[model samples]
Target: MADVNPFYLGAFAVYLLIVLGIGVWGYTKTSDVMDFWAFGQEMGPWLATWSFVANFVSAVSVIGFIGAVYGEGYTLMTHTIFGLMLGTSGLYFAVDRVRNLDLLTFPDIIASVTGYEVARPIAGAVLLGNGWLYLVMQLVGASLLVTAITGVPYEYMVWVIGIVFIVYTVLGGLVSVAWTDFLQGTVMVGAVLLALGYMIFDFGGFTAINQQFAALDSAYVHPTGEGAYTAIGIIATIVAFFGTIFTEQNNIVRIAATRDVRTAKLHLAASGVILSIFYSALVILGGATTVALTTSGLAVDNVDSAFPVLITDYVPTGVGIIIILAVMSAILSTTDTRLHSTGITTARDIYSYFRPDSSDDSQLRVSRIATIAFGITATAAAVNPPGTIIELYNFRAVLLTSAFLIPVYLGLYWAGLSARAILASIVTGATLGVGTEIAGGLFGVPSTFIGVGAATLVLIVGHFLLSDTEPKGGTMAGD
Candidate 1:
């Protein structure tokens, strides 16, 4: 029996209309580079929260989270809770300082904190490297999702998502992504929760799902029954939350876009709590559904399809449309932000780094072009998609978190932290991060956790080793 109905098709049309309308409206207001890039730094708390939280919870959680719980179990959830707790709390100190700095990008913050000489090229490379790969991941996820849901050619979906992202980002910049996120994020959150409730009721009750989980159970109280609960596996669970809140350019940019420090603080604090609940609910729903399917003797290839497959195969017509909306909302919010962010990094961080005297307007134009080039590159990566969202995400998060997390953490608090320490923090963390990821496959060790541990070690040792040196410049973001 074919699962889809015309209702979804109609809903999709409505979604497209709303997206197009928002893009056009945002474009009309974009008059300069800052207007297109940072919403002219006029965002309030609510809008900033959406930009932060929605992008934080995207296709990766939609697919990878459930698959992780199903594979790793309660252990992963424990680690996730730890990481999120750290990230959400750490944001209080870190983000307020960032807000005070009057900077637009992470690169800007770094340059001010460490002196422009060391900060310029390294920050640019970090932002561009981080933004480009992350963009590719989201783009790939979008391509895979559209094709799976619609049975359309993956290329068509890629072009559609890429073009739409490039168009509005070039036109409206952060203003476009931020405003659009509020709408899409709301729809996505509501739809996901609604679907969870409906699915539980449809299955007869929690008892049914529990019985299935019991059968599949290992020692892990898995939020579903996955084996992800090992010592290091825990750290890997929600590393992205920590990684992005500090180092991710999009969040930094969004925070920078706020009108003042108070607004930035309000939005990020609110976003962290809201996003934590949202993420927990999503993983729970995924685990429960997988248990149900396994109980019924059905096998699913990728966890990304957990919600989508259930909607198409199990849910009623009306209910399914809601789920599709949720999925589309998540996809759109992430892609739009990524497209804009990658462009910002390329133009602001890399290209302009080489040419300091370039006009802002000229830089903005170059950013848009880079956006398109990166879009195509990302499309290629996502078309095939590397692995489940959680796994690929964990790999990226571990590497990124190790490399940047310490610098942000120390930079915000430890006032006497030397310039040499800051450099060591980045260098050591990055070196260990790569080594961990590469070693996992051959050595049969968990790379994600291994990398995090190694990075942590290097960060600590490197800092002490450089304790004697004077910071090359005055520290702090606004200095």
Candidate 2:
């Protein structure tokens, strides 16, 4: 390992203090389970908007995504950026309805719409599983970036970052997560813009950077790039991203926290626009990193190291520090949100299902405990990740979208969906999705399509078969 830079360590320490301070303030404001999970349904447009962006974009975008572009070319843009935009568009129609549900957790919405108390725990289980994978991905990406820049061992960085975020999240829940996310989101965008400008200046222009990147490998200029990403794989990835609005608990919680339907819609629209611009900058920076590394004859151990290596070795100290903070912000923002969501799922949906008469204080205590437990577990897993950051993200997304997309959205709008059918959809979709992923896709088809397709089929057939047996007077929002 290289010698650690005092300046970088100092900057990271200051950032942590600032976030922890915010967490303490948030704790002062949080008094009940509602405040912990949904900020008492009082978030305004700007806070909700940036929090949504920070939670969604993550270290995957800053570290793993830049690395993907450096290695795979522009094809990843289609899989991630375009897919994210498509997913955000779907949220435009969903926010108003979801916000109107007046629910604390995503699984609560599931139970409300299906009129089945048992549906809550079933959906909560899927949320916990997906949230765990996503939390691990964020920690892995953060640790990789920190290790590359600070010369710290990956395992130590994982524990440090994990413990810090978990403490803050447990202290204040969504209140802390949202406030800190706002700060992190601002830092992330500013740092990205700064880095992008510096890279463009160094390369002379965008076209020059592209020319140099293409010269290194002509395949880098192609839409599909040099990766194993086939057209079908790209499409499947896009669909998975598009379905995130329907299934992601973090996003759903943000929508639910907004003060009104208008605020929720505004938040989604603003976040989508900001993310589009942010991701576009990242793509350019990716190409620029390719040019810089090739010209310097420097090679990275993996694609995920591309951004960190560029900022640390190639860029100036001040700019590098700021970019490092941005990467940290991306990691912390997402990790906190995921941690909080996972905790809420554990307490509100899963635990409450088993003990329906639990008091609000009891649930709140359980939520904090669950957050700490999952945080420690995820930190341990990050020490030895199962796969690359993007790969883990895609796997979680496919499983989540497949299992929850049809049931959550349809249950919200279609009153005819029986609780039994909804439960079956979750099980079938999650099982097939995980199975297909383990098998490396079903004979060339991506797991997203296979799982979602199977889930949809199961939901429709099960509903029709059991509609008469189950009484259906659920309070579906659309109904």
Q: Write the per-residue lDDT of candidate 1 for residues 194-273, one digit (tens) a residue.
A: 97888678667766655656667754364423543455445454674466557778878888889998998888788778
Worst-scoring 10-residue span by lDDT in model 1: 470-479
| Local accuracy of candidate 2 as per-residue lDDT tens digits, 242-314 | 8876788888788888899999999888888898899999898888988898789787878887888887788
> What are the models' TM-scores?
0.89, 0.96
In candidate 1, stretches whose alpha carbon ends up further than 4 angstroms from where it belongs are 1-4, 218-220, 223-228, 236-241, 441-471, 474-479
Q: Note the residue pairs that clash in candidate 2.
A: none
What alpha-carbon RMSD in Å does predicted model 2 have with respect to the real structure?
A: 2.3
Q: What is the lDDT for 324 in model 2?
A: 89
The candidate that wins on lDDT is 2
Report lDDT (Cα) of residue 225, candidate 1.
38
